[model samples]
Target: MIIDLRSDTVTKPTKGMLDAMMQAKVGDDVFSEDPTVIILEERLANMFGKDRALFFPSGTMANQTAIKLHTNPGEQVICDKYAHIYNYESGGASFNSGVSCRLLDGNQGMFTANQVLEAINPDAFYYSQTSLVEIENTTNKGGGACWNFNEILKIKEVCKSNNLGFHLDGARLWNALVAKNESTKQYGDVFDTISVCLSKGLGCPIGSVLIGDEDIMKNAIRVRKIFGGNMRQVGYLAAAGLYALDNHMERLNDDHTKAKQIGEVLSNLSYIKTVEPVETNIVIFELHEGVNEKEFVQKLQENNILIISMGSNILRMVTHLDYTNTMHEKVLEILTSLKF
Candidate 1:
């Protein structure tokens, strides 16, 4: 059996999700007439207690649009150094928003209120106006690490004092919420804006929703257009998002359980120096000194197991709806049998 653990983005739509998409009542979404898209956006907004939400083609566009909406040219966005906004968004903050980053060396990609306070500019003319603070929940490079809600509230207080806009890259927020047993409204209460992905752990085929006040979302819609994200008849995909929201969210715990199981197996292996905390659905670990990353990955590939080597010694595996209990067992068996 082939096991694909590269990323949660690889999940295929389930039969129920496909049925929803096929039955979707589609209309021109660019004209704001798609019923399914409207339902998905409104449902998510209500879930988070936000005034409004806008759907996008990809998480990158949703996040970049949030940054652009919150900041102006030559402004700064504060975030963890390993954040997806800074590392994976292809420099869209600089290219689209004309802003630079104030990266904090945060613990597992999460910073505290004090960290935000220290990072904000002091209104000096020499500094890039620190207008935005972006955070990624279930921080991708941090093995799906989640932020403490109290820490986030403290950071929100700091942002209020600094007049900084707080944005959440909540691509995996559902996983974080399920793992932490937190309410979605708590997140909505803290962040000025949030970008939630439907395609990741939610198991939708495509789409992301950016939630904020109506005014900010109006700006995001314009930014989405500039980023070439305007769509027509997108309800087919939005139907999938709505269906996933209704059916797939609670099951994310299954993915988290699978990840911890994998981590447990890897922790006992001789070649795995350490496994990062399995807080949610991602498992990241460092290889022992003698094991070459390429060779390790090649060995797994030979066994029909796929994963990504983040660096010379680091490997990453993400579990989602597509990965089953059998797949996890097979991966553990292969890891247990591998020789240094």
Candidate 2:
């Protein structure tokens, strides 16, 4: 059987999720009449202890919208060097916001409050006004690393003292919360704005939510429209998000466990130089010299085991709702049998 570990974004909606989507009550959301979308927005807002939430077609749109709301043209956003906003969003941070990023060399995608304080520009006519700070939890490029709550609180304090707007790229936040046993309200209390994805480990087909105060969300809705993200009859997708929120969250621990199991198998491989700490649901490892990434990936492809080779001789595998325990065992067996 094919074992797809490329990313959790590949998960298909389950039968129950599909059923919920089909039964969703839809309306023109732009006109503020979509019952299902309204329920989803309210439910997520309450879960996170935020004043309001706005739905977006994708996490990228949600993040971009938050950035647009938090800063104006010719401003700057400070974040980790490997953050999704800086690395994976196709330079949208600059293209859409007309702003530059001050990237910090954070550990596993987490920068400290002191880092933010130091990155802020002095009040001057020549410098771009540093107005925003962005953070990613369960950092994708950092092998699914998570931030400590106290660390986030420290950063929040710095933002508050400096009057900088704080935004969280919480695309895999559910996974982080599960891994850390943290409550959604705790995150809500710290971030000025948060972007939560429904398409990742949550198993929804599509959608994300941007949570913030009502005033901020009002601006976000307009930004969403400007970005071509406004949706009508989107309750069909929102229904899947609601279903995932109710049923798919606690199960993410299983995915995390599976990732560690894969990490264990990779650690024993002769051709693996090192395996990054398996946190949340991602396992990243570096190949030993002479193991060409392309050829190795091709070999795994031949076996119908899909994965990705990140740069620097690194390979990444993600466990998700669709990946079962049996699949994890089979992957281990396949790795154990491979020869360098």
Candidate 3:
């Protein structure tokens, strides 16, 4: 049996999800007539207490659009150095928005209010004006660590005092919400713009929702057009998103539990030097000296259990909707029996 743990994005739609897609009532979305797409957008927006939301083809586009909306050209965005907007996204912040980023050094991709205040540039014309602050929940590169909610509130207060726009790259916010026992309204009240992905943990084929005030979302439609994200009759895919929202969220705790199990195994292994705390569904660990990363990955692959090597010594494994309990048992057996 082949087990793929590279990322949750690899999850295939289940039979129920496919059925929903096949039965979706679709219409052209560019002109705002797609019934299913509109329903999905409205459901997510209301869940977060936002006035409106727009669907995008990908989370990157959703995030880049938020960056463009909150800041003018030549201004800077503040975020953790490990943010997906800064590291991933193909440099879209500068390429699409003509804006720069002021990265902060935070614990596991989460920074404090003081860090935000310190990162903000002065009113002087010499530095890039800091107009926006972006935060990622269940920070991906930080081993899916959830931010402390109190720190989020403090950062929001700082943004309010600084008059800076606050945005959330909430691609995995559902995991954070479940792991942290936080409410959607709490996030809705803090952020000016929020991007939530349907394709990752939610198990949809493709889609991300950007939420904000009606006026902000109105402008987002034009931005989506510019980004080549405008689609017609894509409600077939939106139907899968709607279905996932109804069925897939609660099961995320299972993924989280399995990830912690894998993390515990790694922590006890002789070849592992350190394991990043597994807060949700992602497990990342560092190999001890004298262990070849490529060879280690190949060993697992040869065992029919696939994972990802983040660097020469770092490995990443993501638990997802499709990773069954039987596969989990197989992985546990393989790890326990293997000798490095």
Candidate 4:
């Protein structure tokens, strides 16, 4: 049995989720006629207390569409240097929106309100207009660290004062809500737009929902279509998202527990130099000098376990719905016994 701990996005649909998809009532979603897609959008919008929501094929598309909806070409978006919108989206922020990013030096992918104030470009003809502020919850490159709620509120206030649009890249927000004991409506009230992923912590095969007020969402729909995210018969995927929302959210805590268990084992190992804080389902650690990173990963793969290197000496493991109890136990046993 292969234990794929590379990412939550690697999870296959559970039997129940697949059943829901099979039974879904599908119609052409480009025409807004797919009943299941409409239901999923409404469900997410209501949960976040937003006026509307639009579904996309991936979190990247959802986020890129939101950026375009919020800003015109040549404007700047402010976010942490480690943000997915900056680092992982393959320059979609620049290519899709034609806007540059003003990156802040933040702690674990979360920038403070004060930092936002400092990063905002002065309104001048020579400077790119700082038109949007984007934040990530359970920051991916930050070892899945969650932003403090108070800090988020303070940054929202800064956005309002600066007359800048705000967006949240809440890809792993289900994990954040579980870890931080926060409410969905709180996020809805703060940001003008939010991009939430169903494939990440929620275990859906494919989908992300962008939430906003009616006007912003309508603009997002047009941007999404322009980005080639419009789909036909997408209700089958939407049904999996609905199923995941109902069944998989609460279980995210279990993945967090497994991540912590792995962290503990890593902490006790001699080869590990540092373990970034385990906040949600992602555990990231650095190896000591002289420890071959490639060799260590190969050894784990030889044992039927898989993980990913996050460049430098850092490695990452993400637990998800597909990482069963038996697999976790086996991984724990292997980790504890490893010589390197």
Instruction: Write out the backbone clash pairs for model 1.
Output: none
- lDDT tens per residue, model 1, 275-297: 99999999999999999999999
Measured with C-alpha atoms, the lDDT of residue 326 in candidate 2 is 83
**Candidate 3: TM-score?**
0.99
**How many steric clashes between backbone atoms does each model show?**
0, 0, 0, 0
Off by over 4 Å in 3: none
Q: Each candidate: RMSD to true structure?
A: 0.8, 0.8, 0.8, 0.9
TM-score of 2: 0.98
Q: Residue 156 lDDT in model 4?
A: 87
Model 4 Cα lDDT, one tens digit per residue, 1-340: 9999999999999999999999999999988899999999999999999999999999999999999999999999999999999999999988988999999999888889999999889988999999999999999999999999999999989988999999999999999999999999999999899999999998898999999998787778778888899999999999999999999999999999999999999998888999998989999999998889999999999999999998888999999989999999999898888786
Question: How big is the positional error of residue 327 in model 2, measured in Å on the Cα after superposition?
Answer: 1.4
**Residue 218 displacement in candidate 1 (angstroms):** 2.0
lDDT of model 1 at residue 220?
79
Superior candidate under lDDT, 2 versus 4 = 4
Off by over 4 Å in 4: none
Q: Which ten residues in a row have the lowest lDDT in candidate 3?
A: 213-222
Tell me the deviation in Å of residue 92 in model 4.
Answer: 1.0
lDDT string for model 3 (18-83, tens) is 999999999989888999999999998999999999999999999999998998999999999999
